[model samples]
Target: MKKIGLIVNPIAGMGGSVGLKGTDGGIYKKALKLGAKTVTPKRTKELLSYIKNRNEINLVVAPGKMGEAYVREFNIAFKLIGQVPEETSAEDTRRIIGEMLNGGIELLVFVGGDGTARDVYDAVGSKIPVVAVPSGVKVFSSVFAVSARAAAEIVDAFIEGTNLTEEEVLDIDENAFRDNRLASKLYGYLMVPNVKKLLQAGKEASSMGKSSVDSKGEIARYIVENMDKETLCLLGPGTTLKAITDDMGLPKTLLGVDAVYNNRLVGKDLNEKGILRLLKKYKSKKIIVTPIGGNGFIFGRGSKQFTPEVIRLVGRGNIIIVGAYGKVSKLDCLRVDTGDFEIDKLLSGHIKVIVGKKEEMVMEVRC
Candidate 1:
């Protein structure tokens, strides 16, 4: 049987819903104080449950909440690799992974976001292929699978013998991210099963070229012209959405959710609680969003503040997606992974995206 290693970063995504962009460094403590809950447990369980070839492999997992807690629920046989304290850190992730490698694991399946990906790269490098489950806040790295179910599929493909390819691991600055700036750099690469359809494309920065800028302007103009003055508009992050706020001469949090009413900036850098409060205050509400350039994710990637609760309140009919033609034309389809299977299913299907002035494209939203 193929020996696969599993590692989970227990506190990886605690900061997303609370408006802290990432959980790196000491931000997880802040997330806890703000009532953030553990996100990786559900994600880890989902990945384990979806692996169709569970009987074909022997599992090696980290101790406690890191890995063993979830694997024990499944019928699969697995051994504990390393011990961890109540409060786990990045060092624990890297150290345990090293032990798993030394124990002769054929492949590693890690559940976390970009920070956890970097830890995996540091521990294994190109030594063993991995299936990265997207459970963290800033999962902008290309090394991750599109979703938990997709990660399971990648594992099955690896067991059945698929070619391996190197995917980039992005290093994002959490401090800068919380301050309304996206500072990211290519940190390293990890070898993954070359399941192109199941893997997510890495996040691409917005283009500043003349044509791209003009297209964004066109989209922004159309949205601003059609906006309802009586409706409370919740604007998601990205330059395209920023253009809409720019058109009205209102300030926007470049990487956080904001609220607008009557073309006024009512709220800036709103968290889940803040968003819910605004949703309650305003009767007529709508959400305006732009997909990540390469991954084509309208939610569940960068803007986690638009939690499932917020989305349900806004409803599907009130959501407006906008993208520039230069970017939208290349994407196969849009995607969403809100961590709630029900919400994801509710968002899947065909949707309209405003590409330019009076121009719209019908794109399918895949969960």
Candidate 2:
């Protein structure tokens, strides 16, 4: 029988939406005291639903509360082979993944947000095929399904002899917390179903970069020259691309991505809704963004302004990647991460991003 691994971070995303930021360390203690119920452990129903009908795959579990509870809730018979650490952190998650790899499991399906992804990445190192069911507050990496039901659908596809693909998973800055600082770390990679569209976690992808002084004055000039007063130009976060905000003579929210049109500020630090609001106010919209060096993720870090709905409305053609010529030429391929997997897949194509007018360079971008 084919073996499938199941594990759960019971308190993974409990603090989200409740204004607690994330559940980590003793934060859950504070949450319980704050009159908050531990939210459903991330992605419980979704992974199980995938196995509800099929008898082809046998499930391998971590331990009692760790992995067994989930399999039992699904009424699926599973063999508990590894012990789950009671007072566990992300490292424990990695340990369980390592155990599963040794067991030769066919697939590794996990639940949680970016933290969980990091654990799996650390343990598996891109050799295992994995999928994540969305159960966290902010899913930013391309490692999860859109919903619990969608995850079930993906598992069903796999069981029915569908092909899967190896996809890169990313890590996030746990120490950064809610300080409005985005410092991410790359753990490793994983494989998932071959579906082109999937929802990633609202993770703070732990990617970092050097604080270099890059003069974006020329790129800013180009944007200002090309922008039509009638069209809306959505400016994303990061010090490099934000120069457009200054050239437009509008005060930039250093922490947030904003929108400008007809020489006026329409939105500030916009999320999916805020960007869509700006789009509705002005139908013709253009999105401007820049990728952090060492990590090619285009969206989902500090810039939630260009949300999935907004990107869809504005369309990919209007999206622009602005950076120095040196920054632009360093990439072999452009990465797509809009916090929405389906939309990210929609943008899966190769394109040349021209950073400055005088300095011409070509970079391959995959959506």
Candidate 3:
């Protein structure tokens, strides 16, 4: 049997819905204080359900909430590897990985965001391929699959002898990010299954050329001009969407979702509960978002504040996607990983994307 290493970061993604941006450092306590919940368990469960060759694989997992708890529920043949403390740390991750590697795990599949990837990279480097399931607040790393289900597809391909490629392990300093500055750097590389369309590309920094700026302004103009007075607008994160707020002279959170109504900022850095409250107050609403450059993700990338519930409440017709011409041209299609299979299916189709003030194009969105 092909041996596989499975590890879960129990606290991954806890800060997303609470507007903490990430759970790194002492921010995890702040996230819990804001009523953040565990998302990694549910995410890992979804990924394991899609494994078709479970009989051919032996999963070596860590103890308790780290790995064995979820693996046991799935009935997949797994061996418990190591003990985990009540509160886990990066040291635990590295130690568990070392044990798994010594046990001859062929491929290591982990569930977390950029931080977990860095830990895995430090332990294994490119010695064995890895499949990362996105369960953290900011999954800017290319080492992760676009979604949990996609991670399963990549694992199946790995068992089928698919070729592997070295993908960059990149992460940002969350402290700098929370301070309204982006400081992304390449940490290392990991060998990953080269499954086209199943894996996501690394996030690219926004190009600040004059034309890019001009295009954002045009797109912003179009959205503002077409705004319905009675509707509440949920502006997602990214500089492209920030342009709209800039044109309206409204303050915006660079990495959190904001709410606008009648060309005014209603709420900034809202959480899931905050959004639902706003949705209840406004009968008419729309969500305006821009794709993450090089990744083509309009939703389910870094902004988990626009949860599946928020998307369903707004409805698909009320969703407006905008992107700069340069960014849109570089992408094959847009992607979404909302963790809701039904919702994902509902969103999979050709949709209209506004690229400029008067320029709109039809593009396909894959789940």
Per-residue lDDT of candidate 2, residues 2-86 (tens digit): 6888777777665542334456667766656654444344247545765544477788887866678667766665788777666
- Return the candidate ranking by TM-score, descending: 1, 3, 2
Q: After superposing candidate 2 on the true structure, give the runs of residues whose Cα lies further than 4 Å from its correct spot.
A: 1-4, 8-57, 61-113, 117-178, 184-214, 300-305, 337-342
The per-prediction tally of clashing pairs is 0, 16, 0
Please provide, for model 1 over 198-306, each residue's C-alpha lDDT reduced to its tens digit, 9 standing for 90 to 100.
Answer: 8899999989999999999889999999999999999999999899999999998999999999989999999999999999999999999999999999999999999
Better of 1 and 2 by TM-score: 1
Look at candidate 3 and give me any clashing residue pairs. Answer: none
lDDT of 3: 0.90
The CA lDDT at 335 in model 3 is 91
**Highest-scoring model, lDDT:** 1
> On a 0 to 100 scale, what is the lDDT of residue 98 in model 3?
98
RMSD of 2: 7.5
